[model samples]
Target: MIDICEESLKLQEQLVAWRRELHRCPEVGLETPLTAAFISKKLTDLQIEHQTNVGGSGIVGIIRGGKKGQTIALRADMDALAIREDTGLSFASQNGNMHACGHDAHAAMLLGAAGILCTRRDQLRGNIKLIFQSGEEGPGGAKPMIEEGVLEDPCVDSVMGLHIGNQFHEVKNGQVGLHYGNVMACLDSFKIKITGRGCHGAMPNMGVDPIVIAAQVITALQTLVSREIVPTSPAVVTVGIVNGGVAYNIIPDEVVLIGTARALEQGVRDQLAGRIENLVAGIAQGMRGGYEFSYTYGYPPLVNNEEFTKGFKKTAEKIVGAKNVIEIAKPTMGGEDMAYYLEKVPGTFFFLGSGNPEKNADYPHHNARFDIDEDVLWKGTALLAQGAIDWLENNGGPA
Candidate 1:
């Protein structure tokens, strides 16, 4: 509400510089040492109190205001994919890693917010925690950070973060998109192994066919959502990996199947592993074969707090015009570890549309050529800064 739009806009050049600098040397997963050091240096320069090496190459910066009030946290992911850059820009990375997911832009925007909030720390009605996390691509950094207590000490009243890219088709360039409830699916995975007696290639009844049992299991897995789950509720069960015998002439004694499952609701998610196991067990036994099954629950469904999202929307509307703020029509099947933070706290995650065809920045996330429209960087800065301030101004108290 302080009309920091102009200030945010003025830092456009700095934002681009930060993004490009980070982009030039991308690091992947939880091993982002250089990226972490760069962010710590920037926070040090801003004179913001922070902690590094949090939850594996993660950084947490605290901005305490003069007034007694609530606390809110702004988060940004810092990990890159293991892809080599293909973009012809001068800043295109020569290293083996790539910030193909717009994480570089995410960090730059949060740094911009830090700079803005740092100058006005004393006048604010609440405190702000800036979380720079790594390993969003794999293994996950959010859960570890939460385990390490990133949401405690100051005891965050609310939390928020944003992703920059074309994940949501409904949101155009420079627009902000959000969903009231479920916005992303759970990142859960499962593995199934079938065992049977091995025999010669020509023998049919001599050996139990594990391959045949696996085929049945795979086909039946698809029907879990189509038949078992409610038609209205969105869910997916995909078998991405299937491994068995190398030779075609022989029926192998064992077959292995690996797949991922996604759901928007907690009940559906909770039922997936058990349901899958039961289905697989019945089929394997019915087919006269033995089996092994394992299910790992990753990130939970990313749900937005209704009241928090509504409040943030008003702040978003003020930062970017009302016309630029839009509701995401549907939830994406893709998963994010940000869901972990939202589960433990009242918060919302949003999208900062960076897809611009003219600048050749419309490539999908995780692509080697993916890039962001630099013009919208300031808008991201303002939205995060304003969103945190508004949340704190409305809710007063701290840990």
Candidate 2:
């Protein structure tokens, strides 16, 4: 096997520069023109066969080895958030949008992986597909990519993705965190509108107060999370936004509440939804107000295939040593669109710690201050490259 780690070391500066360039020109979900163009140019320069605009602004690069074996996919999200950059770094986001999720690093690492695999194609055992996805933050883009037949064209038997997290110490560099079974929770948002009679605030008893009704509904929502749901299972009901009266002297006719609910188990998610509806209706009726609830499902919970990830653990052990690989104690509540890919094909998704406090790169994801240790970029690239090549060499073809 070729020493991918050593090769990755030589490409460190190039990867960091690429990541910073992407960071500066951050784009929102499903509209990554400049980002896709940059990826296309790099792939073209490397002589890698690719397909652009697969599933809306996403890019896919196919590098074939001398001998064909199994086809595996390595994916990375390429979209930034709507938040303004506050880090004040030299390569801070140009516009209001910023890479608060470290997707810029993910994209750069995958690009670096492609370069390494292409240069060492002679030693590669099978074909590798590089997928640069967009809109992973919300309103999923993975389903569309899968619907567009990116996986079918190459007949990918398995897929893998890496996320950067700010959870570990500097000495924990190159560590791989894995979780079996459910690794992320299902997310769904709900909007509730309460209608009531509007009257002068001076005589509150003259009309049904929507603000009071909304407050009651919000408090009642806690019963579903605490009193009714199973104690062992986890669930949350948060009312992040509530809008009602415009003036202090006048009571508004309607109050609108918007927020989200998350649960690891599907049954729990369903139960919570039902309970929320009942609670809202009961509360509104008690206050002589009418209520309507609108719900929309987001990404499904991420369930990692145990057998597939067992194979991945061995690959990680070989590439980064056993000491660097650690199994997660518990799954996270955050949702990821990578779950869509795993639903189609068996795979393992993991986190690569890129937080180094000493370098002031330890902010959490989605925070404006969020930054990542660029050194982890090379390690991530090497790991993805080795995982794809190693899996094919051992598994041969799709089962």
Best by lDDT: 1
Which stretches of model 2 miss by more than 4 angstroms? 167-171
lDDT of each: 0.93, 0.87
Residue-wise C-alpha lDDT for candidate 2, range 103-178, written one tens digit per residue:
9999999999999999877766678889999889867779888999879766888999989866433326568888
lDDT of 1 by residue, 60-80 (tens): 999999888988999999999
- lDDT against true structure, model 1: 0.93
* TM-scores for candidates 1 onward, in order: 0.97, 0.95
- What candidate 1 gets wrong by more than 4 Å, as runs, is 397-399
